[model samples]
Target: MTKIIMRLQFSKTCAFSIVAFLFLFSVKAQDKPEIKIGGALRFNYNLSSWKDGQKKRGGDFGYDMFRVNAKGAYKGIQLNAEYRYYSEGFGGGMLKQGWLGYNFNERDQIQVGLTQVPFGIQQYNSHNWFFNLTYYVGLEDDHDMGIKYMHTSNRFEYQLAFFKNAEELGFGNNSEVSPNRYSYDVAGRNKEINQFNGKFVYKFGKKSASRLGVSLQYGGLYNLDTEEVGNHSAVAAHYELNKGKWNVKAQFITAAHNPENADSEDRAVVTMAAYGAPYQVAADFNMYSLGISRNIPVKLGPVSNLQFYNDFAYMEKKAAGFTDSYMNVTGVLVSAGNVYTYFDYAAGYNHSWLGGNFVDDFAKGNPNAVWEARFNINIGYYF
Candidate 1:
């Protein structure tokens, strides 16, 4: 009887301790950080004249992608990340971007990890669904593992960054270079390393809404075959103007890459890869792009607005006898509650990703290559 009484007392003590711990934890939870999650589900429909089989079968519609976004903040610390999943024919799955950041003040912050490279226009150089030629050449919307410092205000904004290298997929220094990625990178016999970037923008007009910017980038190309380091550099100037519901964007870039490949390898072209695929691109080129977009308020059942856009880009190769490349896309974006859709009519000539033979369209494309057109529609629901 005495032993049973002692056991009951012990149980009561344990229960009291647990209740006290829970109370303390609930009080402390109010001070903890908060995280938010968001994502999107997307699908695509395409009809290309170049695809004889698809054209004969009334074109094809299939899954496009699904992505997740995460963001969190507490005090001066911030976090951002996104991951995407695609079909096997694409790059399967990859991290679009992720970064940890600290804000020193309202206008100054620093980001570390895989971050977007500040080049040409701010976020995008094109308005259509398909980006400009700069994207295919690894200039627009490029990201690398780096550290970046940014300062922003109404009058001017500037950013400086240094990337040790592109994102790695395998372990160790001798691992094979994989092409399964979202952004184009040097993958064949070379890798990009020790890259530096600087971008400055001046704001003026219409309550400081318009912007003019210049961007500079320099990097080393490490050749695995020759064990030598080559050099690459690019300079770009961009301008953006906003008037009422209309927006205009223009940019010009000159880039050159000198890769130290083995004696047997071709030096005129460098192999670039993304989306689980590899292709050759010219080593030196000059490119320019222009885009215009206008937003119109409309009421079409669940749809609330419409944005019409036209984007065009041209690439002129520096190598003698190399054919030039160009792309043009005209599209409209429809916004309806949590759903958005894009209808695009895209055409290209001697350009990769449009109907050109994936081999050398961006290197020394067929001089007689003709224009090819494709119609595409993409729909996405976001939350």
Candidate 2:
């Protein structure tokens, strides 16, 4: 009788073990895939001086800025954030970018929060991946808190966005005007602006790999004080050719005139005249750039690979409804190392149409050159 009871217990133990194994296998099958998280940090330094009239001035050396970016992705959702700190004397300070995105399908997605606008290529491209070229155009710090929709397919992709307008962030008084008063007040604080942006990307080549794209953007700032409005627009195009380790890219952009809106023409004239004649009226801005980058494998000391590249840029600005133009040129060089580290050197020169006097300089035929240089060390990991 004792032996019969032992056999029965052993049978029950075997059955329990089988059941547990099956349960564990099922859980493993149902478990979601792991999400990916990664980020990078960057620091830059700029030591530069200007030479004018046999004199050297405007020289300083300091930590320019630091930036951190983080990103994560799960099944159909993505989160990205960036923070920046500009050292003293820079025009900007601590800034932040955070956004949450959801992909409805493989070809469509929506993002909302504080984020950079998808208007220009340079604005969105990662710094580590940049070709390191000096583009003579002014960098735009345009950010908005809003929602954006993007769609991409085999042959075409497009984006549309709407956001809060924050023009007051750029307001200040000049010495030529009241010390405590604003030069212009076209829009009230805390008002929302309507922004519309669109892009069409087309691909060609046997495998549909090469691409050409054009984009347009329009924004309106409404004054809550007077119900008046200011407008801004931009049109741009880009083309890319990729083959093996060699790639070439070119782009052009034009911006509509943007003049300060004031309560009265006298105030407007004073502000515009002080700023410059070209700024008196709204004007269009133009920028064009060409870049070529190649990755060559070279074994040198502790570094196994290196990439050498160069980029050139030209830009022009014309007053609204005027034929006069100012031009600028920028050149850049990059040397990349094997450990995902790089050194970038850039040089730039600016020429104004206006002469010596502020107003006449803006009028026409005024040309002077201002040179600038920047050097930076970047370290990052990319996946």
TM-score of each: 0.91, 0.63
Q: Native-vs-model 1 lDDT?
A: 0.87
Candidate 1, position 363, lDDT: 93
Report per-prediction Cα RMSD to one decimal: 12.8, 17.1
Best by TM-score: 1
Kindly list the per-residue Cα lDDT of model 1 for residues 1-383, writing each as its tens digit: 78569747855764574444334334322256879999999999999868999999988999999999999875545689999999989989999899977766689877877899988896889877778889998898898987788999989999998887788888566555688888888778889977999999999997876999999999989898787889889999999998899999999999999999899998889999889898999999999899999999998899999999999999999999899999999999999999999999999998778897987999999998999999999999999
Clashing pairs in 2: 257-283, 283-320, 354-361, 354-362, 354-366, 355-361
User: How well is each residue in 218-277 modelled by candidate 2, as lDDT tens digits?
Assistant: 775443334455566778788776677766767778866343445543212111211111
Error of 2 at 116 (Å): 3.2
Deviating ranges (above 4 Å) for candidate 2: 1-39, 45-62, 72-77, 91-93, 122-142, 166-192, 223-227, 258-260, 263-282, 301-304, 320-342, 351-366, 370-383
Quote the RMSD, in angstroms, for model 2.
17.1
What TM-score does prediction 2 earn?
Answer: 0.63
What's the true lDDT of residue 254 in model 1? Answer: 97
Check candidate 1 and list the clashing pairs.
none
